[model samples]
Target: MTYALIAFALVLAVGVALLYNKLVRLRRAVENAFAQIDVQLQRRHDLIPNLVETAKAYLAHEQATFEGVARARSQAQIARSEASPTDAPSMRALAQAESGLGAALGRLMAVSEAHPTLQADAQMAALHEELASTENRIAFSRQAYNDSVTRYDVSVESVPGVFVAGPLGFKPAESLLEAPPEAAVAPRVAFA
Candidate 1:
């Protein structure tokens, strides 16, 4: 009877240790995923200046648009640096800042469309292509981050983990950046 009790306690100890380690591993994965997002966001921010300068060369009359882009970019940089991707409030602020930057970029692109010369410029075309590619990468990174967060949250809230997580103070992580509502709906296309 004594040996049976000892064996049961030992098994329980091992189980708890394993679960704790698994929780820690999941938390680390979430952090790494968010780091990937940070890398892509930095790449996008770096490209913005070059893109803006290229547009400036041709759209000399549109000073205000450029200023707006600059301001938005600056705000985004601040938000990106100040906020952790796993924190809800900080992530929301970062998303808002990024949306503002996207809006500025869209306006610049629209205005550039009116200038045939700018459209024809090879440099502008190349910058636009790079920007598009970077946007795709950012999207992928965000998806990965969200997936990691989901997995981590599930582990924290499920089964034996539920018993361990609360005492360990393991809270669910926030999802990655979400698309702004204005950008969520597909634009209607009429072939007329």
Candidate 2:
């Protein structure tokens, strides 16, 4: 009877060890995912300067728009400096700044459309393409980061993990990526 009790204890210990290792691996993956987002966001930030310079060369009248972009760039720098993304107020400001930059960039692009010479400039066109590609990469990286966070959040919240997570101060990770406010509130159309 005593041997049977020892066997049961051994099995429980092994199961716990395996679960702990899995949890650690999952947490590491979440960190790696955030790092990837940081790298891509940094790349996006780099592209913004080139794009802004190109716009500046042509859109001399739009100094205010340029300043908005510059300010957004600054806010983004502060936000990314943290080990984790900030909560609502800072996040909202960052989002608003990014949206302003996008609007300014769109207006800058429209200027290029109006000025045939500007659109035809090889360097400007190339920089615009690189900026667009960088934006896509940033979007993808954020998605991946959120996915990893989701997995980690669930793992920490569920069954056996709940037992360990509470005592260890492990809690659900904040989702850094979310649909822009415009996207969330946009009117939807349905097809038959």
Question: How does each model score on TM-score?
Answer: 0.90, 0.80
Q: Model 2 reaches what TM-score against the true structure?
A: 0.80
lDDT per residue for candidate 2 within 77-173, as digits (tens), equals: 7766644631445545545555555555565566566767778888888988887887787778778878888888788899988887767666566
- Clash pairs detected, candidate 1: none
lDDT of 2: 0.71
Q: For model 2, how many clashes?
A: 0
Query: What lDDT tens digits, residue by residue, belong to model 1 across residues 90-152?
Result: 888888898888878777777777788999999889988988898899889889989999999
